[model samples]
Target: MSSTATAAPAKKRGSGLFQGLQKVGRSLQLPIAVLPAAGILLRLGQPDVFGPKGLGWDKVASVFATAGGAVFDNLPMLFCIGVAIGFAKKADGSTALAALVGFLVYSNVLKAFPVTDAVVNTTANKGVDVAATYNNPGVLGGIIMGLLAAVLWQKYHRTKLVDWLGFFNGRRLVPIIMAFVGTVMGVFFGLIWEPIGEGISNFGEWMTGLGAAGAGLFGLINRALIPVGMHQFVNTVSWFQLGDFKDATGAVVHGDLNRFFAGDPTAGQFMSGFFPIMMFGLPAAAIAIAHAARPERRKAVMGMMVSLALTSFVTGVTEPIEFSFMFIAPVLYAIHAVLTALSMAITWALGVHAGFTFSAGFIDYALNWNLATKPWLIIPIGLVFAAIYYTLFRFAITKFNLTTPGREPEEEIEDITKA
Candidate 1:
């Protein structure tokens, strides 16, 4: 008559973390994927390419330019959509709409008064302007607004209000609250715009001033931060968060080093360094993976590798490929990190000035080329990097017996599946 001990119920895995990660991945997918196509269009529309009597392909070029230009120009809208869906509990339409409301409020409030005009009229010569708040509704800003809307929706979506406002309570209340909240944020942004912008610009200059070594550091850190999704924070500090430098007349000017590279293209310096790594290095790495695979698996691996490589090279969507080998061959991953650092250093040394709205892919290269000071050099530089990547990866795989692709044991694969 001994009492049998009941085994504790198997602990259920938290679906929240997984679901959240999926949403973020999904949110980023479309925007990141679309960048390369945009880059190509931008390249086609360059004055040299599409100008009058320049090329017979003007019509074809125009189409690419229009499509890419649309995405590049409306980054804020894209961010809003991405953030809303990424943060929503159910990925519903209401969340997306709420995000739009937040964006609209922030935009309108910021636009109502131009900062420069206000500064001129004010007694304080150094006072910040209001227009700066609306100037660049970047990815970070979109995320913030989206999160605000999501939180509001989650908290009040089911709450009942007084009879007079009952109809407007719950789901309908989200947009209303979102707009009001955005307006409040607009006021705060307007007040601090100048100081925030200046601080960010100074930081960008400091990083840029470090030259090749700085680029290497940036590359290593960027990759390290990818797994947790906090790379966005670094992005904001380097790109969108920084304020634009200005000339003596107070007109916005490019930072010295950045101007020397891409001129006044997009927003940041760190983004430019990625062009070499993404367009050339990653694809080469993919080739090495295919080459290292067993003969029987080569065709299948090649197909997958080609698709993933194309996406990385063309658009800068690298997660699928990076994740492939990251878990299986961490030593190889470390090598990849070092190689990435070297690529950034090399690009900096060459004075190549390509930048990207997305990843360092061909599409971004194409889009940003015209805007870049020496866009033609990007391809040549990237090609060189590609060669280096191939040699290094191939050698490392064979010499070290790195478990890259075909090296994984059947039992290990089975265990991974079971887990």
Candidate 2:
């Protein structure tokens, strides 16, 4: 009667919710795929690990920084393009074009709202001032617009207009719908963007206010939700601008990564803790999992296990190892989460602020090294956690007889001889 037994059926029963969520998760890949380059460039622009801090490194680093900043700055547009393409039922150019059209409609309409001001300002030539305050609405806004565009594209792409107006039928008709959809969206957000933005910012502030405990909680939630693939949504708040930070520079930063690069003193509240887990802890788990395999299977599984460990350690991708035991033994995963939470708390308390361009792999760790408060601290923390993860995973897997991958029941295997 373990919850793990019901997880699959429960997912199937909630097919609508799960499928849509799965699609959103899948759509995220495109935008995320581009992040590593940006992160590397940003790191290159920062003062080197051995050099002094501040803008001095900008001369050489500026090229890379600006290159990377464009991606960070225009995340919304990228999401619109990425998600529209991802969610489109068919690979058609119209869907992508329509997404852009939708984005422009929302951007332009929201800017010119409160008609009197738009008109008066235009006449008085104070429109520039009005434009100055226009909020870009960032990634969250982009996701919404992208989803809306894809839905419209899917629904309208095949529509046929009356023969008299047939020229605007089929693919041509989608953009027309998106234009209206975008305006409606624009008008909708124009009135309430402030409250919505403020609410999210407040939620971020609340999370950050709890300090190390908040980070620990996030770590637990992050690992806990991986079974459902919904952790990314939770992470979106911290990685992007779920929280708002207004800095001394009179500029505003919304997310952990954004605030960190913006030179906000409190940047990396959510990200700093993951380095230990990704670069070391998970790899150790991989090793333990491999070692716990029956000796015969151990040799067979070692190559795969080693690759998973290296991938997680080098690039911070953990799905391979996480999937190894996520379902067959939920208890182990729960323990893993608890360990992750502890790691988060420890690192956060120690004030290690290294953030990542991609995952908390060695690459990002090295890149964000100089940008942190005590980046060197993660090295020792990660090393210690590796031993902890190895010992804990080995002991628990053996004690509970958890069926992690190569150690699965023999009868469960598909035999080619029988087939």
> Using Cα atoms with residue i matched to residue i, what is each candidate's TM-score against the true structure?
0.74, 0.87
For each candidate in the order shown, give its overall lDDT on alpha carbons.
Answer: 0.67, 0.81
lDDT for each residue of candidate 1 in 66-98, tens digit (9 for 90 to 100): 675676556666667666766667657777787
Question: Which residue runs of candidate 2 sit more than 4 Å off their true CA positions?
Answer: 1-13, 47-60, 113-131, 246-251, 412-419
Q: RMSD in angstroms, candidate 1?
A: 5.9
Q: Which residue pairs of candidate 1 clash?
A: 36-363, 39-367, 41-64, 115-129, 115-130, 115-131
Return the top candidate by TM-score.
2
Per candidate, the number of residue pairs that clash is 6, 2
Candidate 1's displacement at residue 261, Å, is: 12
